[model samples]
Target: MASATLFHDVQQILTAEHPDPFRVLGMHTVSLGGELRLVVRTFQPGATAVSVTDEEGAEVAVMECGHEAGFFEAILPRGTSAFPYQLQVTWPEAGEPALMGDAFAFGPQIGEFDLYLMAEGTHLRLWDVLGAHPMTIDGVQGVHFGVWAPGARRVSVVGEFNLWDGRRHPMRLHPAQGVWEIFIPGVQDESLYRYEILPHQGSAFLKSDPLAFTAEVRPATASKVADLTKYEWNDAEWMRSRQEGDWCNRPMSIYEVHPGSWKRVPGEDDRPLTWREMAVDLVDYVADMGFTHVEFLPVMEHPYDPSWGYQVTGYFAPTSRFGGPDDFRYLVDALHQRGIGVILDWVPAHFPKDAFALRRFDGSALYEHADPRQGEHPEWGTLIFNFGRNEVRNFLISNALFWLDEYHADGLRVDAVASMLYLDYSRGPGQWVPNQYGGRENLEAVAFLQQLNTTVRDRHPGALMIAEESTAWPGVTQLAHLGGLGFHLKWNMGWMHDNLSFMSEQAIHRKYHFNLLTFSLMYAFSEKYVLPLSHDEVVHLKGSLMGKMPGDAWQKAANLRLMLGMMWGHPGKKLLFMGGEIGQWGEWNENRSLDWHLLADPLNAGVQRWMRDLNALYKREPAFWETDFSHEGFEWVDFRDVEQSVLSFVRRGGESGHELLFVCNFTPVPRYAYHVGAPSAGRWREVLNSDAEPYGGSNVGNGGVTETVPLAVHGREQALPLTLPPLGILILQRED
Candidate 1:
């Protein structure tokens, strides 16, 4: 190369502005006097002198300072070829000279095929290709770092290994793939790192790795190097059963919990329980409660506690707030071992505006829309993902699989799905952008969701993809190939809202608002549903389930038991947020533990007992779940008793001949002889009564048995004249 060109390249390396540092800063063959010669170049800013050494640590040649900024170069003896080498440097103030491998010495670590997949946005195992992965390259052990930053002038891996200096370890850019990578030998796991990106038009700034598997606890935003392959999981049986079992026909009673507030150590400043601790305490609690699964609010790394893990920053990491990534895996394994499935609340709807996160990454709207109308979320003060971008879609889809594949999560309850389905969500007219078809729908997001569901369904046969969508979007739980959203289940938000509203009305007014109680049946079988009494209803001063009920404390307790019974007996899967089962009076607070002391109160204890018994009975009876999404599973005997605020229904297990009758009395008034339709004409046993004394009710119900008379009623061949409890529910099954 010409002397002037060499000087300019050396200057670019010193200034950290070289787009491709590998070409000018590493060993290369150059022409000298019409003959090719091996030349080695390095940049060590603080070194007083530098020497090139062979693989055996023998000094090969003393390098001369090619620039005043500590640029060093050496010409090897003629006839030499490129071989393994290191730099031995002498510092004026350091006690000893440092010997280190040249970050630019290695060739591109990311394979061309992987790069092509990444560019195509079809890299299913993106985490494996992009991120700080500790591996052995060319007989040398080091950490290989890769990131996508197409618009950046330069990208460097800045970490403690390089004294957090971008100039020390500028990465090599693969121009065709828009990926930058460097294999920094001696960089080990648990080291903190960030990417220093020099945008095309502005100053350079450091951003956390988008594919970090573990991150520093909040209040510190650096990404930590983690080894995901080390965790030895012991849930083989659980995984196998999960893959083959038919989850839709099985009973799934989920106990939703917020890890940070579920329980806290009073003696330790009320800090939340760690993952290992929860592995024992929370696992035992959920198991004893008879819940089939435990759904955690997002456990992914997030900075704001108030957002309740909804505003995600780190997509691949399990939050370090509880413990390391493996600790979380241990918790999941523990749950699986206890015969409990785990569902993680995944938030791909939006992300916070933290500077160190994905915001304006690579000095462009790489992961989000550049236009505010399309990129911004007004209500959340967050940023919407640009689903149209292939790489962005890949990032999210890959993240969803990461939890299910790496963490062994049985399902993912996708959060704020309604926000992603529409372009004008939570927006007024003129505040949003329309798609190419000029419709309110977000076509890109819809396509992304369809692809996401299809990929998850194909990859994990039995794992669930549940949507927490609140809109009236058709076919949410239908098959994607049939023009549906392809969700295994969707939360029945309409049922929750209508029922809660009815339950809150006074007994006198409940009769007037009877439709609220029976209106859900009209569309209950439209989709596979999970009737969720989730955290959202209990937060933001919406009040706790207990507080939402009308009348005195006794009536409130009875009402809560009745509500729970209705939810379980309804033709849908169930999910109850923590604190609801215990009749907690206060709304949920993310900052503190649940009111555990409420268990001391008999009413609260009774509510808890009622929930446990309800779950036990629900799981034992396939009638409640076997034909959940089909009208065949549910038959309304009578919803016409509106004047008395009563409802009666029969749930049947198809072909199994298993049947259960659910009769609910919404008002606090006992009826001595209310005739209810029976499915058969034999002995019917009272399997569960919410009004039993054990559940803090008046105990007004049949004495464990009722005989059906041959009289016709509600088009059935038999009828049962039974005593109806006040504000209570009774579930009866035929003995013969």
Candidate 2:
């Protein structure tokens, strides 16, 4: 080689501006005189001397410093083919010499098929290809790091091993896939890392791995390399049955929890419970409460505690606040083993503007829209995802599958769906861009959601894709092939709003607001629904469920019992927030425990008891859930008793004529001899009475049973005269 060209190469390496370091730095066969020889080259920033050694620890040759900034090179003896080698270096003041493998010597670790699919944005198992994976290549074990930074001029894997220097480990770019990757030998598990991206047009910065499986705790934003395959899962039985079973007709009573506040270490400054602690405490609590499933608020890693994990930074990582990835896996496995399903709140709607996260990643609007009108969420001060971009869509869709496949989550309760559905959501005029067809609907987002649901369900049968959509977007829970959004269930936000509004009013005003109680029936069967009294209703000073009622303390408790009874009897699946069962008086606070001391009072304990009993009855009674989504399962015995603030309905299970009559009295005034139509003319037993003394209610109800007289009422063949308690709900089943 010529001296002038070698000197220029050395100058480029020193300046960290060389785009292709592999060609000049690694072992290469070059022509010397008339013979081909092996030349090994490397750049160590602070080394004074370097030597090359063969696989047998024999010193092959002493390397000469080609540049003052630590460029080293050595020529092997003639007639020798390339062999495995390592570099031994001595620093100016180090106690011992260091030996390490050449990072640039290894070829690209990502396969061609993976690169092709990644570029096409259809790599469903992107987690396998885009994160720090510990692997052994050519009998040498190391960590292979890969990240997509199409807009970056150069990208490097920075971590403690490299002194966080971008020039130390500049990645080899696969321009076909826009992914930069390198295999650093000797790098192993639990290594802290981030990508130092040099953008084509902006300043260089560091960003966390979007596909990290576990992350460091907040206030420290570094991605941790984890081996996720080591966990021994014990939910195989549950998984196999889940795929083959029908979940639609099943009774689903979900207990929504924010685990951080569900319980805390007593006298430990209210420290949140860890995943191991929750596996012991929270799992048993949910099981004992008779809930069929447990839904967690977003468990993904986030920066601000106040966001409660809604604004995600690490989409594939379980937050380290509780424990490692294995700890979360144990939590899910424990729940499934105990016959409880797990659902996660997934947020693909938006992400926070944390400088170290996805915002302006690669110094460009890569994951979000380039324009503020399409990218920014004004109300949340976050950034909306660019649903139109293929890679961005793949990121979200793959993330959804990751939770379901990796964590064994039974379902996803997609949050902020309404915002994603409409382009102008919470926006004033002229603040949003229109789609190609120029409608208010976000056409791209709609397509993304449809594809997401279809792919997830196709890959994992019986896995629920629920939408928390509040708007009247048609066919939210219908099949996508039939022009619907393809969700298995959707939260009945309208029902929650109207029911809570009606129950919050005074007794006299409730009669005037009777429509609020009956209005939801008009659309109850329109889609599969879950009546959610969720965390949203109890947070942000909206007040607790008990606090929302209008009355004295006793009336408040009684009103809460009636509300829960009515909710259970309603023609929809049920979901209640963590503290709702115990009549928590204060709004939910993420930082504090759930006022567990309230259970010491009988009134509060009674509410808890009522919830348990209600869950049992809901699960055991086919009439309540066996045909929930069909109109045939429900019949309005009478809903026109507005003058008395009363409602009556008959719920039927199957062709066997299994039926239960539900009668609710919203007023606090007891009524004697209230005649309600019965489905048949026989003995009707009062199976459940919410007004019973055990439930903190005035014990006025039918004494176990009532006889149906052969008198016509409400188009039925018989009528039963019954005593109705104040603020009461009664479930009566015929004993035929």
Candidate 3:
């Protein structure tokens, strides 16, 4: 038998007699009679021909997708909704059209889902790209709807399509699988949809589906409702460009911002600014900062404040709070035009109940798990996914690919990964489940993560993928073959917590916590890391970064400057949440604009100037850019000074050697003749000085120095000396 072809277009099918309309990712015939359904499939691109078999060795439903050009539509089984299935591509080749991959079971569900819920309403909107191709709704009828109520005897799916009605669309349950579904052709494309889940024992529950892409609400944590197909995308090059791997392994400096807080534009004040308003100002500001990237807090959609967008419901849609989907795409395009990449904060770990996309979808387990342990996240009080369920896995993975494929996102920072990987990551042992082996390992979750990274990387080689896993998990940024969980970078949480704590305490406290300051460097020693003064630190405990400072107002500002200087001194890449750059005095509030008025203040202006100068020096200094990934090129020159509240270090590049000596003084008292350490004795010149009067520092710098003086310690070129003032940082470069 000739291997089944995975795909053949209507043209190919009409012309060739036995032409397979779909490229056979794999193919296998199985006996679908009893508890088992097996099938085999063919492979075209990264597809590993799958063969599902019964106990009698007969094939059931084979899952596969090929890596060929022009094979976009997936041929799905009739009458069954595609909820969960694994889409695996070779890590470096996954993308639209053709990128070889695999699909596995997410329970009995078949297709991937797109849920990101909103706050309320019975109407739900579902959309997929293929939905636009044919302009017809086929096989979408009878899309099941049910609610999971171990406590419920019945569950129904209702929506706005039925006059805010759900009782009319009741879903039946699969006794063995514990799933509920409905065959609904009426809930077609672009329709506002929601499920009126009838709990068996309680009154009919009103909830949002967890699988909505564009919801009617925001933050996705409130009741989920969506107006699907409302936004129109204009950039085709974005999708094409993403598949090229044009944005990987590069130095990434992300400006984390909230759109609503970033700025407001005309026609959008009483009405919040649209994506266009954001694109105009934000693109220019980020470009001016020399930052190569911008990261948005779960901008897709959510309802309430989980503070910093850790809780998400809408997976496919951009937050209505920001703008429509196409409008968001335009913003991404604008960033791309400015040579800045866009990275979204993706939350796949859990979703809030306010989301209606999959809220009791089909009256049983649809987007999430049917069981309590599998569906609910104990620690976060959210809904967790069953990775072992193929349909659910596909739903998540497909969305990852969709953003890169449709929206032009250059990178993604997966939030709360630690929660996703471990059984009881934040909770105690009693909160989660363990693998068959009885250890802490959650094999299914691990496998899902592996597949996610692999598939995402394969699909968008140039786009970046990052993890926010706080646990010292091994191999977070390595290729799978190297036994690593693949990711480009991990947020240096340990450093942020330790450094912020050390800086927050009075100067006396910092001296005793030297190890805390000294040890963070080690975390950077492995894997590419970013020293993020991320939004995480400033908003929650005790207020803004400056608010955490121990001294008087002047001292507070000085220490804040010192902390920033230390950030520039460190070896890893750097990131600063918005407003931090200009010294916003208050904690982040989603409701208000960053206090741009503060920039008008002299002291704050100086802070801004210092930031600019520092960045200029950082960019110009060859030592900061070269061999930043390796350990040998970077070394801590010193950390012992306490009286003057100073810390100094050298950022060295590889053998193409450029030694950058950084001297920082935290105290407000003026200090002179600061002796900074260096590796060689050369005519040292001041490449840049943050203490220059233009940057709000004391007018006490010569602008340049030429000295090749000899040593107090000759082994590494003895003494490299300089002068410093309160809240000062000096960057010195070796003479050529």
Q: What is the number of residue pairs that collide in model 3? A: 125
Tens digits of per-residue lDDT for model 1 on 1-736? 3588887888789899987789998899999989999999998887899999987778998998887778899999988878999889998888787888887788887899998988898999899999999998877778999999999999999998888989988998888878989899989899999999999998999999999998999989999999988999999999999988778999999999999999999999999999999999999999999999999999999999998999899999999999999999999999999999999999998998999999999999989889999999999899999998888889998998999899999999999999999999999999999889999999888899999999999999989999999989999988889988899999999999998998999988887898887888899888889999999999888999999999999989999999999989888999999999999999999999999998888899999999999999988888988998899898999988889888999999976879999999988889887889898888899999999998887789999999998788888888999999999999999996
In the range 369-452, model 2's lDDT, one tens digit per residue, is 999999999999999999988889989999999999999999999999999999999999999998889989999999999999
Worst 10 residues of 1 by lDDT: 1-10
Give the poorly placed runs of model 1, Cα more than 4 Å off: none
Error of 1 at 161 (Å): 0.9
RMSD of each: 1.3, 1.3, 15.1
Worst 10 residues of 2 by lDDT: 12-21
lDDT winner, 1 or 3: 1
Error of 3 at 234 (Å): 7.8
Instruction: Give the Cα-based TM-score of candidate 2 against the true structure.
Output: 0.98
Of the candidates numbered 1 and 3, which has the greater TM-score value?
1
- Reference-based TM-score of each model: 0.98, 0.98, 0.73
C-alpha lDDT values of all predictions? 0.92, 0.90, 0.61
By lDDT: ranked, best first: 1, 2, 3
Better of 1 and 2 by lDDT: 1
What's the distance in Å from true for residue 340, model 2?
0.5
Candidate 1 RMSD computed on C-alpha atoms after optimal superposition onto the true structure: 1.3
> Could you give candidate 3's per-residue lDDT for residues 564-649 as a string of tens digits?
87787776777888888777789987776788888777667777777776676666665775666677766767777766667777
Candidate 2 regions exceeding 4 Å error are 1-3
